[model samples]
Target: MRGSSGVAATFWSFLSISSSVLALEQQPFQFEAMSVPTYTLPPLPYAYDALEPHISAQIMELHHGKHHQTYITNLNAALKSQAEAVHAADITTQVALQQGIKFNAGGHINHSLFWQNLAPASSVDAKSSAAPKLLKQIQATWGDEAKFKEAFNAALLGIQGSGWGWLIKVETGKEQRLAIVTTKDQDPVVGKGEVPIFGVDMWEHAYYLQYLNGKAAYVQNIWNVINWKTAEERFLGTRADAFKVLKASI
Candidate 1:
């Protein structure tokens, strides 16, 4: 009887250990490096106050440091979850995470471009003359700079809610055209053959603190700090060149 009892106890202990090993194997395996953040915020290309008078220092501080960083943080979290989902082959969780990834990724991409699209109001790069080739293209499309500004500002004001206004260079085979386009919420300007030459953030956080409810004034004054040099480069460069800002962040 004693021998039979000892054998039964050993069998049960072995089964328990085997079950624990199997359970550990079934859990998603994560590398130590996976715990580290996959994405980080890029430094502002210029000082927070550089676009002052047109865009306030306080707004820049909050928008770039707080708002933009939140997007990065959320995006990293979503991606980490996605990696685990992929490892576990959890299709349902992967699908649910798509919207989070999209929104946060778009926010990062748009803001990366936004910072480069601005310069000090007093800098020569902020002047329209800094973009002669782009100016010619704009003139051909909108008759002249003034008319283009009018059309662009109208697009900015026409946005029903939080969004963005863009001056995009569209290419069709051998031909190219410049168009004023708007993207709703955190959606990016990502159509094929489209290169975003410059973008104006229409989200209230972009202008609300300084301008109060005067959104039109914010639209009108943003041009004062528009980085024409960067616009010209994006206009002349390929779509890949335009998105290099995003790659650099990674």
Candidate 2:
């Protein structure tokens, strides 16, 4: 029922569909029938306060528990509605439901990746050394690590409103490169041959309580908690590896 205007405000509890869920980005979510599988918010890999000093416990609790859960809740609602619309052959209702599905679904996918993309600030995974291969590609693309972070932070700050900033590994033919990209609102990086190495949630809810209006501060401190080991894995693996959590989560 936590949907936007113009959509039905009804929600239903659903049974877990499949034990083997495909990587979300690789398998675009489809609404076929009433038997759709429900999405659940995956738990954080570390404690809520694990990234302390850089990201607050309060923010992590609300961001993961409340915000991310809302996306799953609403996504289930929208998908359920889409199923009914399809059954009735009501093309109008089905068409009107796409926005909610895309927004909430993107929110779920983005946050799922975002949570795994971070580590405890003191963990070795947080260090650039944990990602030598990715670091080399970054250096090749942006001159050096410092320049890469500088460019990524600039992209984060330049976002006009709620969105995300991502460090993505792009491949074309025999060429491979690292790039910084941004997605508006709850939109996700779902490009072919592109793997999202790590993403920073730029929504005000992500940093407003801790950083207030100083989003730049939030952007900078975020580097200290990034899961570079995970980044290295994604950069070296296929796009499916970037969202491997989807295959494990309910």
Candidate 3:
């Protein structure tokens, strides 16, 4: 009887230890199977109506709340469905997902920057001016601020379809120079070996409600709210070596 009792106790103890070991073995697999990150639309830096007169409140509401939200949703969905391919670094799968990722990601990125590049015209101090360094650079590159605006507006007005006009700083040999460039669709300016200082959305949705096919007028008004302070910060913070490899490849 004593022997039988000892055997029964030992069997139960072994069962308990085996169950614990199995649980421990499954933990890493459970962790590894965790879901991929879901991207969300970021909130505007200012109120929806903060950029009013230049950019109407209704335009801001639709552009930020609806259009931008859709991009974020699609991006998250694409990333989630393609998690395995992305994790394995599969080139074919990555190529398949690239366009969708770029379009949506570009929309999100572009809109975010656009919001930061504008402020209330009322906020501008009557006596204040653009950061002196940025102003000096603009003058040097385009002869004067007026000429720069003329060139920038011309570039923006020339976009035949939905796109953005950007004022970018490119490293030329040992020095950086300002240039105006346009990108079709929702393409971003970064991969071109340039740092974008200012950008204006030339998409109809950005102005059609208020300007009604008057893209040139829309471009002109946007400057009233342009955030020169932000542009100056970007210019000052840029490092000469930041795009060294990119410049070399070019």
How well does each candidate superpose onto the true structure, as a TM-score? 0.85, 0.86, 0.78
**lDDT per residue as tens, model 1, 1-250:** 0134444544655575576456545654544334433667889989999888899999999999999999999999999899788777899999999998989988988998999989999999999999989999888889999999999999999999999999999988888888999998889888989989999999999999999999999999999999999998888877766777665576
Q: Over 4 Å off in model 3, which ranges?
A: 1-34, 87-91, 125-128, 239-250
Tell me the tens digit of each residue's lDDT in model 2 across 142-175: 8998988998999999999899999997888778
TM-score of 3: 0.78
The residue ranges of model 2 lying beyond 4 angstroms of the native Cα positions read 1-34
**Deviation in angstroms for 242 in model 2?**
1.4
Error of 2 at 233 (Å): 0.7
lDDT of 3 by residue, 1-250 (tens): 0134444544655575567456656765563565665666667768989888889999999998998788778877777657767667687987899899889878876776677677788775211275568788889999998999999999998998899998887865667788999999899777544777778998898888999977778888898888887676556544322222222211
